[model samples]
Target: MPLLRMFRVFVCCVLALTAMGVCGQNSLANQTIKWDDYTYKFLSTGQSAQVFDSAGKVVGTILSMNGDLQMIPLPGTDEEKLKKSFADWKAFYARSHSAGGSSSAGATATPAASSSNGGPAVPCPSTYGVSYFDGTAWKTMMLAVQMPKEKSVSLSQGFKDMGKNPLNPRAGETMIYRYKDPAAPLTTGPNPSFCVSISANFNPSQIMIGTVDIKKDHREIEQAVSSRDSWLPPKRVQQVDIKRVSETVVVVTPKTPLPPGQYVLGGPPMVGIYDFGVRASQ
Candidate 1:
C-alpha cells in the first residue's frame, strides 16, 4: 500500500509541474505583446494624458492634439512581436493592394511608388506625431519607425546626419517635435513639409523613410513645430526631408525658398500638420 501511495504522489507531482509549465507559457505570451514605458500630455488643454503599456514601460503617450503618440524602443523581446506585426502589416498591405480588401466594391489599394528623386508622387501620411482632435476629444495616432535597408544609401546618410549608431539605431528611441513658431500653421497638401524635432530620440545612428500608402491621404494633415537647422543645413531650409528615426516616427524638413514672396517668418514644427509618428498596435 505504501508503494502505491508513493506512485500516486509521483503522478500528482508530475501534474503539478505540467500545470505550472502551462501557466508559465501563458504568462510569457502575454508578455510578448507588452511594450515599453512612456508618457504624453496635451499642451493646449493643460490636461494629463492617459498612457498605456503592457510591459509596464510606457511605449507611447496619449495626447489631446494627437490621437496616440508612440516612440520606438530597442527590440529586446518585443522583436518577435515587431516581426509578427510587420508581417501582419505586410499581409494586410498586400490584400489591400490587390483590391481584395475594402469597404467599397471596385475599390483598389495602390502601393506608394516614389519617383526617382525618392519622393512620393503624392503627399506622404502624417506618420510622425500625428494628432486627431474631435470637438472635445483628442487622440494621437500610434506608429512604428521602420528603419531603412542596411545597405541602402538613405540609411547610411540618415545615420551620418543624425549621429545614430548604425548597428542598433532602433533602440529606445523617441522623438518630440518642437515648433519654432508655436502659432504657425503646418503645411497640408500634396507633399506637405515641416521641420525636425529637437527632443531626445529624434535622431539615431541610422534611418530610412518607408513606403507610405497613398490610399489614406488624410495622414498628411498632422504637424508639429521645429527649427530647420537642427538636422540639415539652412540652405536645405524648410525642404521637407523625410528620415526614419526607428520604426515610430519619420523626421521631415520642409523645402526652402518659401512660396515666392513667402519668408520663413518663424521656426517650423519638428512634426508639422499631418506628421504621423510610428507605433505598433496589439
Candidate 2:
C-alpha cells in the first residue's frame, strides 16, 4: 500500500509539471519581443509580426521563421530625421534673410522697404514665384529677386530697361514657397488664398497639390512627388486648384492656404514639384 501511494504521488507530480510547462509556453507565445531599435508585436508565432518605433509609428514589418527575424523597413520611417532637416532649412533661411544676403527661395519675406513710409518696392526674384490674396489685397510675395534663366531670356531687354538687368541667369532648383500673414490667427477652415507658379508645363489631370503631414519623413515627400501613390496613406488636401497660366507656367492655387505646415505640389513622377511650408507669425 505504501508503494502504491508512492506511485500515485509520482503521477500527480508529473501532471503538475506538464501543466506548468504548458502555461509557460502559452505566456511566451503571447509575449511581445524587443529587438534592436524596434519592438515586435507578434501576430503569429513563427510567422508574421509588426515592428514599431517608440512613437508607435509602424517603422517596419517582421517575418519570423525557423527562429529567424527578417525585418523590412518602411520608407519614410525616420520621422525625427526628416523633422531635423526641416528645422535646419528654416534656421539657415532665417539667418540669411536677417543678414539681407542672397539665399534659396524657400524662405518667405515681406517686400523690402524702398522708402521710410514702407511703400511697395520691386518684387524680389524667387526660385518659385508665388502670388496670394491677403483678404484685402493681392500681394506678391517675392522670396528672391533674380528671374529664372528660362524667364530671363524673354525679359532680358525689359530687365535692361529697368537698369538692374540680371547679370547671370539664376539656375532654379526644386524649392517650396511659403506664405503666411503674421497678424492672422490659426485657422482650420479654408480662408486664405495661396498660389504657386511652376516653371514646367504639365497636364492638369497629372498635377496634384496636397498638404503634407510634418510627422512623415522625406520618403513620404518623394512618394507624393512621384504621384504613384498618395503620401501618408490618406492624402491630406483641403482642395486643389491648378491652372495653365502660360505655356511655361502652371499655376497652383490651393482653395485655402495650408494653415502652418509642410505641403507638396507636384506632378506624376514628380518631374517638377515644390515642397514648401507655412509658418504662423508669432
Candidate 3:
C-alpha cells in the first residue's frame, strides 16, 4: 500500500514538473537524476533521493525541491500539505521555466488511494528513483546498508529510528544512516529493473546487484565486513545491463533471468543491508 501511495506521489511530481519544464541541465547525467543542486542540496548531484530533514520528513520531492523540501508533505503523507506544496511549487516552477502556469501541479488527481490488490487501479510509476514493477504496479525497493560490528554486519527489514541502534551494535557502529526494509523484495520478474539516482562522482555503469548468501536458519542476513573498504557495498556479484535513461536515472536489469534464490541490491545504501528470496519460479 505504501508502495502504491509512493508511486502516485512520484508520478504526480513528474507530471507537474515535466509539464512546467526543467530548470537546469547537468553536463553528465544518465539514468535517473531527477532533482539537482539547483533544486536542493540533499536532493542534488550524487545525493540520495531518500533525503530527510531533521523533522524525520522526506524532503526530496518536486513539490518542495525549488523551495524548501521540508515544507512539502512526505511522499505519501498529508494531502493538504501536498496541496499547499503544489501551490508553492507553481511559483518556483514558473521561475524555472520562465513561463506562466497555474498550480495544476499540486492539483494532481491522485488515483484511488491505497487499495487491496483487488481494489482501484494504481498509477504507473515514473522512471525515477530505485524501483521495479512487481506485477501490480511499479513497486519501489528499499535501500539497505549495514550495521557493522567488529567482524560482521547485520541487516534488518524496515529498520526504523535509524540512529538508535540496539545497545550492542558492538557499541561501536557508525551513525551515518537512513531507513530501509530488511528485504529488498521482488514478487515477480526474474530480470528485475532498478532505477539508480546516481550522484556526481558515481558512474552509472557501476550498478550493484548481487546474489545474497542465505543461511540455513534464514532468520536474517549478515556478512563479515572485515574485508570491506567502507562497510561493504551490497555484496555485488551479478553483472547487470546498466542503461542510462533520461538524465541520471540508470536502469539496471539482470543480464539473464535469475533463478530462485536470495539476493541483494545496493551500491550506496549507507546504513543497513537487507536480502530477498526469489522463489517466483517455484
Candidate 3 local distance difference test against the native:
0.42
For model 2, residues 210-269, the per-residue Cα lDDT tens digits are 664333213122121112244222445546554332223333455554576655445534
Task: Give candidate 1 regions above 4 Å deviation.
Answer: 29-282
State each model's C-alpha RMSD to the native: 20.8, 22.0, 18.7
- For all candidates in order, the CA lDDT equals 0.31, 0.42, 0.42
Query: Higher lDDT: candidate 2 or 3?
Result: 3
Error of 2 at 10 (Å): 99
What is the per-residue lDDT of model 3 for residues 201-245, given as tens digits with 9 covering 90 to 100? 455544566665444423233433222353333443676665433
Report, for all candidates in order, the number of backbone clashes.
Answer: 73, 4, 18
Worst 10 residues of 2 by lDDT: 144-153
Taking all chains together, each candidate's TM-score versus the true structure is: 0.18, 0.27, 0.39
